[model samples]
Target chain A: MARLLLLACQATANTVENEQKSMQVAAVDTSKVSTDAFLKNRLEIVRVDKKELPDGLLKVQVTARNVRTGFWTQLASWFMGDNPYQIAYRFTWLDIDGMEVETAASTWIPKTVIPGDTVRLNAVSPNPRCKDFTLSIRENDAARG
Target chain B: MNTKIISLIGITSTALLLTACGPSVKRIDATGNEGLVTVDEVDFKDWQIAAEKGINSLLASGVLNRSDGRKSILMISTVKNSTMQHINTRILTDKIRQALLRSGKVLTTTAVGGNGPDDMASKQVRRLEEDDMFNQSTVQKRGTAIAPDMSFSGEIVQQTSSQGRMRESYFFFHMALTDLATGLAVWEDNVEIAKQGKKPLMGW
Candidate 1:
């Protein structure tokens, strides 16, 4: 009986160690965004597409996937840390001259994502001068407070 | 004496530890999502999300730019608050107005409002025309005030439901821009936010 109990203990420890390793791998995968390092290693940009509207306004859509820590890692996080990450993003419009089109309309829109899920966020330019846009995504660490 | 000293030291350490763990407050960014959230109530972040979606949709529709070589004048109309909570509708409209003005395609007229003139100063300054204490040349003349070409109005509605230990709340923000001349709706948009979580330990 004692031997069996010892085996069970060892199995639990191995599960925890494996979970930690997977979390590390997920972190490393998040640092791939070259344009903005802040979002790197946090979110993976899967696709981006833009189109011009009939009124000459620009619309941009971005598909981003959250880095997944394994099931065991998520279980561990539920007990001791933040699990099921939340994030906020906004789009900054740019004119044809590459200068930012200033508009107070843009706000940080919040979204919640479970591990391994992809979320699509889209935005439209406030005026016809907007020819391009850059999306900014950051971890929604506000709830922790 | 040694026992008493040890007891005193222990009490001091315990007191310090408790103080460290006690609740404290700190400032946070207003425009950012750094505020507390309640499961059954609409929070600031929720308002921001709705406003962002509504303004973006309105701008993208390009209805405000339909005016011929001039910025469309907008008048603030009644925004109905149909929610259980006593929420001020200005929280949402103010954000939209700021964004619309920044776009330079629309201008809000302070000379007219659903309640009254948004800027009473327009009328107040006109009264100065008869006062010798004030310069008549600086006073706004009658008929010089521009009429609003369009009116902005909206409604915010909320619904709540509970299943077992979980509670869900949904808020819908609806807005419309009406052309005063044609008496037709020029643009309309709606934004909905839904949140589900464990029931609050305290009051709703």
Candidate 2:
């Protein structure tokens, strides 16, 4: 009986550890982040999908999950105005030759994500020559006030 | 002994006060949200959002494409400011121009504008053709300027309202592309940005 009880306790501890490991895995995928190493820890990019549109423009969609909660409450956020973990993302398009395809559409865009919420961000290349792209994301420091 | 201890405490307090009064400065990324919002005025982020939406929609519409497989010539028209806040309309137009130019589908003409001419130099150089002060051969000849195929113009308007303690402001950026020959609007888009918060201590 003593040995059986000890094994049961160990199984419960192992189950808790596995649950934490899964949560961490769901939080962020390190392999998918091709650029911006700084955001690897701060943000959780769950999925990235790209396709060529009928017009030859390349469309890219990124789904990101926020892993952190608001540091302040609603009333505190309203009064003192805290940065609600806002993110700014920009995409750089590259042609088949690996040269940068400059487009006016490539600008820093700001997005807000509630804690633990998954949000989809999409962008289309301005021209057909853009066959590849690099996405960069960073936390908005100004919003963190 | 007690007086000496009191003096030491006073000096420590003074040092702390001075340190607290020192100037503090921090640098932040311009593209990210620094959490700056004003109830009465439009902000840079607001402009970015508007420009992004307008450019994206314009590109997706393929209105700048020409049937002749040649780059379309574009002219800047009047962008009327109907908002209460003073704003240079170029903040929105320039973004569209830059995007269209980079796409290699459109070229903007400096010889034409709503006010008169985008660059008076194009017209001023013509006078040199008749003047002996300069070489007539090098001067721009008449009918050499390319006419714009399309004209770009827009309007920016704002609306404000309040209910209880919360106030809201909405800015609408409306843009249209008109075909010069047909005198028809080929493409049009509107971007709206709305903000709601408590009433500020100052201007609306």
Q: What is the C-alpha lDDT profile of model 2 across B1-204, one tens digit per residue? A: 999999999999999999999998788655445547776567877877788778777777878877778888999898888988888887777777787777667899878898688689999998888799888778889988899999999998899998977878898889999999999999999988777788556865
On a 0 to 100 scale, what is the lDDT of residue A139 in model 2? 55
Q: Provide TM-scores for the models.
A: 0.74, 0.71
Give fnat (model 2).
0.48
Candidate 1 structure quality by residue, lDDT tens digits, A21-77: 112122332223343332443367777767777766767778777665677766754
Clashing residue pairs found in predicted model 1: A30-A40, A30-A41, A31-A41
- DockQ-derived CAPRI band for the predicted complex in model 2: acceptable
Q: State in Å the error of residue B66, model 1.
A: 2.3
In candidate 2, the residue pairs with backbone N, CA or C atoms under 3 Å apart (3 or more residues apart, or in different chains) clash, namely A83-A143, A83-A144, A142-B33, A142-B34, A142-B35, A143-B33, A143-B34, A143-B35, B40-B204
lDDT of 1 at B127: 83
Best by lDDT: 1
RMSD (Cα, Å) for all candidates, in order, is: 9.6, 10.8
